[model samples]
Target chain A: MVERRMPSIRTTRFSALAPLALVAALLLGAPMLRGIGAVQAADGGNTIESVAIDTPDQVRITFRGEFPAAQATAENFRFAEAAAPDAPMALKSVKAEGRVVTLTATQALHPTERYKLEVADPPISRDVTPSPWATLVTLFLSSALINNFVFTRYLGLCIFFGVSKKRDAAVGMGVTFTAVMIFTAMTSWAVDTFALQPLHLGFLQVLVFIGTVAAVVQFLDTMLRKTHPALHRSFGVYLMLITTNCIILAVPLLNAQGKVSMLEALVLALGSGLGFALALFLMSCAREKMELARVPKAFEGLPIAFALAGLFALAFMGFSGLDFFR
Target chain B: MSETTERPPGALQLLFNGIVSENPVFRLALSLCPAVAVTTTVANGFILGVAVLAVQVLSSLTVAIARGVIHPRVRIPVYTIIIAVWVSAIDMALAAFVPALYAQVGLYIKLIVAFAIIISRLEVFASRQPLVPSFWDAVGMGLGFMIALMVIGALREVLGAGSFFGIVLFKTKPLLFFALPAGGFFSIALLMAFFNALERKLTGGTAKPAAGGHHG
Candidate 1:
């Protein structure tokens, strides 16, 4: 009887095709370069006009084609008193046309005072609304606490789980992660808004964002390693992990999509990072206690940790009803 | 009776291990991030479940076949690269073919790369096992993950949205938090408590009593 040989053709074909597939990906990815170029061109020369309103009451303002019509209905659109910079007057009513918008105010206008009309991006369909400086302050506070990134949005779970095993490490990692998130968000916003948007490079958003995060994390790691040895030891592992943390990646993309101003972007990044840190701190404390507790064989490590996280998440839900910032 | 006379466990054993005995989410508690994040709606859960299943199976196969050739020092990076490539391919494919689901899942489609479950399996079972056993193990674990996600998603959707898979099952006010981040926590906690209870009941007092510390 002749010895039968099994067909090795499938395995051979798979091995042969793998390199070809990679080559094809590279070739197809070439369009990404042109796309990025388009994004850059579009965002580079985009000019924004900041109009200071001196009126204390609501003012009806209209715009023409120069503004993206979507800005007429932005949620962050507000009127502030020129005399009292802290008390922002809300827009009573707003109406918009192809290029013009009419704003009506409920309060009286103060003569020769400098008030600002601000608009946040998501609620707005257009990009032309003049966002107020106060909106930036609010965004910072809200993003950092009320609408925190990690505790609320649950981004960066992997790093939160791994490095947060100890309280001190968690605090250090949280602060470092927040700092990295802010830096990464700022760079990504600049790149996306200035370089990519004008060039129609939206398709490269994910690739670019991931690359930016990885580079930022690596740079931060190198800097920390050289500057503060003890601090570096505490955050070194978590710093490397931040490369893949989604909050760092997600915030910049969200900023671009939301079309927020530079100030607004910074505030949002700070808030998100702070929120992440807060969540990590709480989780670490809980997990530390869990370490000493007697756990069943089946529910020892990851399982119990997850269950605890779930409860913490539920506790954080109470903030949703506090519509102070919304 | 010699111990060597006992028969080794079969493929069915491997399959059962993944589905129930060693279920990824509830039992092993692996892949909790995606399990919790995507379980807001039934559709999201189903889509995520499929993504996890595909990544787990393909990555397991690759890791098992190349286990001996790859150096242990570089194993993590290699595994991550493999998973990232597959995840990106899935993300693009979804963007092209299933645009609606892609939009709903959004950036999370790319997050599949970071899910610990896929990497954990690669490190634990797939690396040491043969291709056939690894394949069955992946299927079992994948199914286990799918079931857990679907359960959580269904519960959340029904309670939070007052619907299941977008269909209004009853005319009632929804618990909005059930759809938000908080609901993600509450639902998972309750599910875990239920799992603990089930584990105790199934083992018929054979398993050791869970220590108080483990009770989340």
Candidate 2:
């Protein structure tokens, strides 16, 4: 029965996506348009929050203040090795993220050595423009592309492989999964913040999180059935499958573990959902095309698909070293 | 109506079935995520496999014992709760006793409740079988999963990182690609194909394994 209706339904869905694509383009561009005002309103003074070693060769200095966009010269900051105060550490590059600045040293610093950081007289650039939105955008992009749930984290392979046999089903599943992810992420974060943390019921995190995801999916299932019968029929099975999908549950657990703010959690959820969708779409397209070009018997079904996913993972690995805000 | 009249496969056969013929990772293709994700290192893979084994056996045992009492309508959720309780117990235990392993695999520990392998066994094998057979089945499945993970983990560590069980085999890694997530996918793909080919040859093309399905 579903096979008979698939062709017509797919065509209609494609047509429907055109307007959505346009709206998505405009919405995505909306943030860049607002960037003109993104130069933050800098307050009079700034103070250092904390200094921590981010990497073997890098130290991150977080500030409880904002500044305008300006040159963050190495000389503006001072790093002294406690053992050799006279011979200061050399800074190679300095990147700023409004409230956070990461300094890369020319040489790797010993993990055991104590280092002291001092904001020089000219401090981080007075021209440093503060932008909270940029931080959120960076977070979203990093989570979606750099640390993708499917490619990098390996969170949702079951659904990724199961529903990716066909392109239309993949797209439908991606969209449905994204919506459910965003909704569940928000609900789980809220519940953690409001109920679990306050009541000291953190031990029940797994139980509560899985329960919450199940309830939300069940609710979405019924609501979609009643409101949009056509949509439900297409997405009903995927919805049920998503209740136990690792990605759905992982997003909330990650958010809670990271202790990210509500806004950050939402962005993470959105990023992860879109990332998974992107992976699904790409894999489905390749699989649909590969239907004609199989050679080996043993590497026919999942083996081939997995090999393809490995290629995609390699491709996505390129995004790890990218620094957009820098 | 003696016990001898009711014949079933011996416990040894059940164990063998799980480890080879019906291996969870190779045959059923269930729970492939952790099979690939944590297997980058031998220790990570072994620890997660052990944790999963513990959870699988306990959940299967519980379902087998209480199968009659659990309502048909609410069985799925009941199975989930049972799995969750055991997973939570293991999660806390690892954290308290083995904090290092806990830190590396803490998130995945919680995710054991979502693994299709455990729940599927509970629903299919445990829910119907009596206590003793179910216990054997669980043990076989658990050991099969653990052994599979260890093999994969050892492969990745040796080929990717130039190490075996955290001991350096050489000064340099053989192929850095196998250490990355992409390499994980490739290794698993190759292993899956290899297993399939071996199975086909050994069975003289008479037997065919079931296709992979929805997993968490």
Candidate 3:
């Protein structure tokens, strides 16, 4: 009787967990589900993406991935009528040379009015949303507030959670982290552009970037141990662990891909550093206050901290997409 | 962790310990970053958890095999390098052969090198244990972490996004807070409490309180 009952109990347990197991199995199949032909947009092979209108009479349309000559035709390019969605506007002429396509409207185009340019062949802009390209001011704002590495993206979680308990420790780690990030970004950018790009050693990015971070952490550890013993004791180990922080490595990778100039790279690094520090500072203050609040037995410590972090993240969501004037 | 082991248990026991008794996220509270970050969706959580599982297993095997050779003083750096090397290799392989999957979780694959859980497993178990035990231990811990991540992801998705694995389950996001980063905290925290209570009940209320130290 006991043995028979045990089997039934085991079966019940298995049944209870079946939904979880099935969901996990389904998730594992996600790549294949989203894999082939998921979002293949049909755009004509034309090169023009979007036209920038300063004044609506003439606009400069840019082509991507090719030179703009020999593709577009006057008949192929038409602006939709102002009121009608699909009706083409009367065109004076369409001209293309080099990588620029010049569009001239017979009537002055409304600068504020919505206009869609129909092209027989167009670049894949319809399918692919271009990265919010970095400008000096935009990069600074984006990294520091909008696309903050910590509050927004969840990079550098290890330090963000661990050292962000005490205010002093948090401040110490944040300042050190900012300094290290700037230095490493500069160094890695120099190496990547001067040697790696020139030599076409792009495939070696992971190795080079990680190697640079590890070396930077080690060097910084030694320097701080000798120079600032007290600071080292507080969050210096956290500094050494920066070797493992994803922010340090990810920044260099972004810099390599972003193709920003030296000044831009430095600005981005500094902005990201400030952002990280800001996150740590805010989290630390919140955690400090959380100590005095009423809390459940199980929800104390890291659990509460994590919950607080989530709240902060929700708050940070308000800062998203604060774009500059293009 | 070693202090609790007076005698080495069987292979199955080691497996059970990882999934339940010493879960990397819940029991030990290591690698909280990925626990909160990638678990926004069930699919994402599974991908990163699998990546972590692979890295953990390989790192454990390598560390266990080299335990005798690696000097005590230099072992930490050596383990970190090994982890970084393995992670880089995996990242490249995924990008080269499985671009589709890479597109989903590639940002996470490189980040695994910094996971304190991987290094913690080495320091706590793999460094002192034999190869086979270490391998089993890693597999168990990896699975446990994966399960925890998935559970958190499912909750957040089901509540925050009104979806499961990006599938719209409900028309309205029931509690949008559950989907945000703050939602991540609530899910993990609440789920952790439930798990703690369940563990206490399973042990007939004799279980010692969980030491909330998660410094790793």
Could you say which candidate leads in TM-score? 2
- Model 3 chain A — which ten-residue stretch has the worst lDDT? A125-134
Q: Of the true contacts between chains A and B, what fraction does model 2 have?
A: 0.75
Q: What TM-score, computed on C-alpha atoms, does each candidate reach?
A: 0.66, 0.81, 0.72
Task: Give TM-scores of the second chain, every candidate.
Answer: 0.87, 0.93, 0.88
Each model's lDDT: 0.67, 0.82, 0.74
lDDT of 1 by residue, A1-326 (tens): 12222223333345335534643553355333221111111222222222323234434443322556666663546555545545666667666655445566666653223454544542221222223433544465467656666566566765776767888778767767767888999989998988889999776666667677777778888887787555565557667767666677778878887988787888788768767877888999999998889976555555567668767777776766542212
Model 1 agreement with the true structure over B1-216: per-residue lDDT tens digits: 132354435678978888877777666555556666788899899887887788889989988898888898988767877777677767777789888887877667676666767777888777777788788888877778888889999999999998988899988888888887767866876777667767778987565422222100
Best by DockQ: 2
Candidate 2 C-alpha lDDT tens digits along B62-151: 998898799878999999899999999999999999998788888888999899999999887888788888889999999899889988
Q: Which ten residues in a row have the lowest lDDT in candidate 1 chain A?
A: A34-43
Decide which is better by DockQ, 2 or 3: 2
lDDT of 3 by residue, B35-144 (tens): 87788789888888878898899999999998889999998779988888888877787788778767866777777877778988999889988888899999998999
DockQ, each predicted model: 0.17, 0.71, 0.37
Candidate 1 share of real interface contacts: 0.18
User: Between prediction 2 and prediction 3, which has the larger TM-score?
Assistant: 2
Which pairs of residues clash in candidate 3, taking residues 3 or more apart in a chain or in different chains?
Answer: A46-A121, A46-A122, A310-B181, A310-B182, A311-B182
